[model samples]
Target: MTSPVPSVDLRLVDLLRHDLTAADFTVPGVEAVVGPTAAAALHREQDVPARRAVAAVLRAVADPAAVLTALWVLGEDVTRRQVDAALPGLGADGAVALGLVEASGQGADDAVRAAVDLRPYAAQDAVGEVTWWLASDLSELQTGRRLAADHVLGAGGASLTLAQVTMRDPRGRVLDLGTGCGIQALHAARHAGSVVATDISRRALAFAAFNAALDQPDAVTALDLREGSMLEPVTGERFDLVVSNPPFVITPRTGAAGGGASGLPDYEYRDGGRAGDDLVRDLVVGLGEVLEPGGVAQLLGNWEHRRGEPWTERVGSWLDAAGLDGWVVQREVLDPAEYAETWLRDGGSTSDRDPAVWADAYGAWLDDFASRDVEAVGFGIVTLRRPDPAAAPAGRVTLRRLEEHTGSVRQPLGAHLAAVLAAHDRLQGLDDDALAAQRLVVAPDVTEERYLTPGAADPNVVLLRQGDGLGRAVHASTSLAALTGASDGELTVGQITGAIAALFDVSATDLAAELLPAVRGLVTDGFLLLPQ
Candidate 1:
């Protein structure tokens, strides 16, 4: 008879780091192996309770003090006493109480140790300045499962996206919702006067606090770590800037990502939930109330689009409903089936054996969208500026499309805002009389060239280059070319045309009709720059 394949819960392997890191063992290759030795090493590395037990297991094979020194080098936080506390022979109830293993029946430490032994290779590099761990087995599917409370999330495109688009010059206050390891908050605090970071899980919050402390100790002091669902604990509080990389996974959870039996809500850091991307919708809408007037809110989000509906229109409508001036830019779009499979792997679904199950999951995703008439999906960075309703006309919302994506961050974005506001001020102040009298301002690089065919007394055509707005060069009548050439700060269109009439020995009246249009064209097309 054929043997039944064993089903191993992938989430246990995911949480090994949290348990091991807690114990202070420097697991070098948790992502490299499978089975008990890896798990035992992970348990020894992560759990304070597993320290002595893990040490006992290792001492049976390796040097005891050398292992202790390696553990200290990995994390000074772990102590020898803490390792001793995890030693076995303490009682069946005690091992379970100490959290060394899953307390299912009696002594499960052996199983726990076996899992730890499966952890990645733990070793110091040559200089010993930094410790490294491999994640060869940390697949996209594994990442989708519940991440540990102290899960050291691997770097990915999403994290880089958030880093590129987040506001760098924060004012009064800032908040990082779902602050994973406090990366968002850390970046925000460099500019924000005050920062508040919150996560649904305490362990996640603690990790955020630790990372913040390690990087920016003083700013860490200013960070108020709160445990609650998105913005719940901070009701009525507003900020100059609010940033988030919420759990946006569109998957169901099998308990928590961290190992062991913990009741924490599996707030998948990247999941948008199964609610048709409503998680992002609610977050944007919530910021409308939470943002101070003239303040800006930035987010990285994904949206589902129904057939026959323009995605831009749908996203723009959301901003309009929120009563905010938003600049929504859609960066990319994806098809239905491909999107489903990508996320299935992310959610850690071990459906490799069941091709039918994979098809079913894809079918479910399609049906969910089809029922709602969603045809395509979009993901992008959204920037919104809450309007001060009482402010001037220049402060209205604007939406623009970016030409391309540049991986390098645009730091000091304040200059761009200043330029935008300056343009707004200049355009809003234009009166009809000023518009009628607007003069063309020419640049130094502009010149007029006259061309004539074979031996003619008068030039047949006049060419204007660098004088027109942008980089356009055009052929014009001599009268038009003369009008443009005279626009150097020395004279206005009226004066320049009058001089041209005298030079060409033509009537001023005729010149006015011919050159006036060309001068107006130059100013309108921005061939010439006006005084600022």
Candidate 2:
């Protein structure tokens, strides 16, 4: 039976009609009250009369569907009725003082705040409302939230990572592949003259368009939202920048939503269909053609590590196959068992429901891996730039780990790119004296360390490490130990060699001869940053 829709609160509608402005929500002391009180209220057993009154007002609406629609518009979900029940009486303005509307007007940053100290229910509602308000201004807020419920919103971690790692050079046109909520496209529009956003789901595309309007209305003219897979929608169109967070999960055909060969329609966000991580492979493979010469692409994905092949080698092989100059970072890795469980639950499957189905689903995943000789699965981001054939660029690939967990605005990704681009050619031929004459500086938060083997005559090994950012090896070398050690930013190669020869009891001429090649090697590799 189609359940009769319930009624909504006219008071809520009235409040919405006269929305409060951001400046009006900065009441002093109100924040403290709202945080604790709202929390307390959400967990309480007793339903306060004021809260009940608000619930009564909501239930009075003639069409519950309309109420749900309005609530969603207000940046909330109808599925959470308990939250609606506590909305009215619990806010930052003290108990029974004001509702969210009135309190917000009194300078509460959040729509809902705690009315009492340590009130659990109110506090819970406060947290939820805080999240709801973040994406509230965004038109794609509701759809993105609905699609990934209870997950935090806004230009968050994954979003910001893509933004920072995105290719920022001026381009003819940019394409935001799988433009979830139009975030990548919106960011890209700032750099590109034209931007096209593509997604498989019409609903996702709609949200993308709406978000683009809210965030970048003027750029809206240059932005195009298309509904289709990877490059399918814009088959003939090539782009300078292509960014995507495609559906990269690899799972079996049954008991999973929108994955496997037959289930593309069920889950548009992360299901890549074919078993054993085919979606990521397809995306990686196709990028070669979709990108224009000298174009760049950034993608966040997961890939499996089979038994026989190292994960780094496996990914490198793909880049090799695609025939591109790529720098890849494999941030984290998880075993099949742990990886399976995390994603299974993430897809909204409860282990308790249908034990046989859960077991079978998991078994299929393991078997799929076994068949492919897979050992562990890796999750990371890949940035690729198609080489300009005329430039005759070597297809260089780098695989490494990221040390930092959170995003920082101070990162020098731009400088890193600049450094790589500057040193694209071989740095091997410079004589030690010539190399030393060039002023060199290490990247920010980077240092060189020397290590020696115990009881061995072999010279010390030189290693480079970063203080922050990706904090990985610049390069390691035992043969070039003196060259790096002499990089105290004080002496030229001839000067350092003269000193090193004296200290190590070697001839000055021989030391310079030996160290020159090593210093040249350092420059040839990316260990030392050369002056322009």
Candidate 3:
């Protein structure tokens, strides 16, 4: 049976925190001790090199930090002496009392084994950088088996992605839906006056509560922890910001994936026990009800793409039904077979290790996709905002954008995204005439690249590239390039257009008509900014 989540006791947790801090078991500390090669290997879940590295470190010196890394991170057993020395404040007894470890025997000779996975996590956002020790259920590395359905996850790639993308602007109230291990809630608590973290699984809540208490006791103690799936727990309440990394993984409904003898394991951490991608669809459409006017909801999700229908149409339909301003960035699209293999391997089933089970699971996934005529699966980040009824255009939700951006993007995109939304609002209120009268400046992060053939008199192609934000690259026409080159905040857009039209011997009215739309695009995408 799976071990119970770590017990949450304030005083005991404080002692653990002291030990963790004193040992310097932070991200940099761990990286420094393990070095680059082992650290990289650990990320790949290959423990051999990391174990060897930790062993080498221990041999050279009896380092408490190395001992802790070996014991907690590498999932290796530590002697009682090492545990007592490393966590002198929380001793072996205190660790056992806190349910963080199990002591096998009495005295210094006894071996101590970690009952949970604890590691230091460091992150930077709009506010600043923070370091916290996160504790969750031991992974397959420790247990050497597939994770239990109710396993609570620690900081993974998805969690970090959601954290980096989340808007860190201070708000009155925040909601973290599906708060697995409460990572988002912790980040939300940094800026939000108050936070409510809800999850469907009690085990997950327990882990979240423990992690909160362990890291930000004062800040998270006031965090409202509720048990319910999705928005049910926070019904009727509203928030300024809502963030979720929901269980949006698509899974086959039946046990055919397990050779019909045992069906697909519905891991609560990743699967919502719903058919297809209905959970994501429902959340997108329903989450707006709990948002205050002008509130924003950021979430990560997966959507199915049926044959003959573009992914934009499918996701766009969700935004249409949502009745809110939304921007969907399709970060990746995988074919049915690739999607099946990726998720199957995630569940610890591999074709090389178990061909029969792999084949069965693969077939089940393909069959499910066939039933829905799903040709591909798309995954992306979703940002939704409830338009303030007073400020929004009458009877219209104007911000509905579904675009593909699979390339790299700047980290801590909160400021850029908030600016983009504000820019959109400003542009929506301006007519072409009003816009042309406004002065514009090219953003500092933007640069123009001229692509010219060898020995060419002039560049045939010009590209405007943004070094930050979405890392957008916009193709520029000769006239457009000249117009941007002249936009130095000293002249109105109309003035620049007139000058460009004179140089090209074209009508000023036609030039504005051609450049205004592109100018609007540039402003909306952060390539250009209105003068302050």
For each of the candidates, the C-alpha root-mean-square deviation to the true structure, in angstroms, is 13.5, 10.5, 1.5
lDDT of 3 by residue, 1-532 (tens): 5678888989999999999999999888998899988898888877888888889999998788899998889888888999999999999899988888889987797899999999999987767788999989898877787777778888898898889888888899999999989999999999999999999989888988999998898886669999998999998999999999999999988766632565456788898878889999999999889999899999999999998888888888988899999999989999999999888887777523767778888989999999999999999999999998777856368899999999999888778888899899899889999999998899999999999999999998999999988899999999988888888899999999998899889999998999999999999999889865
In model 3, how large is the Cα lDDT of residue 162? 89
Q: Which candidate number maximizes lDDT?
A: 3
When summed lDDT is taken over every stretch of 10 residues in candidate 2, the lowest stretch is: 118-127
TM-score of 1: 0.55
Could you say which candidate leads in TM-score?
3
The estimated TM-scores of all candidates read 0.55, 0.65, 0.97
Q: What is the C-alpha lDDT of each candidate?
A: 0.53, 0.53, 0.89
lDDT of 2 by residue, 1-532 (tens): 1111111233432232223212122112222222444324522412243243334445764233222222432233232232233232322232223222112343333343221111000111100111111111222322222223212123434665566555466778888887765667766777789988888766566545545543454677898878887779888778887888776777655543324432112345656566777788778878978888777778888888887677777777777778777767666678988877876664444523666656665676666667788788888778777777555535334222222233233342433443444464334324445565766654445577766688867536667765543444544544355556556566666676677778778798876666666555445334556765
Q: Give candidate 3 regions above 4 Å deviation.
A: 258-260
Q: Report backbone clashes per prediction.
A: 43, 37, 1
Ten-residue stretch with the least lDDT total in model 3: 255-264
Pairing residues by index, what is the TM-score of model 2? Answer: 0.65
lDDT of predicted model 1:
0.53
- Pairwise TM-score winner, candidates 1 and 3: 3
Q: Residue 55 lDDT in model 3?
A: 95
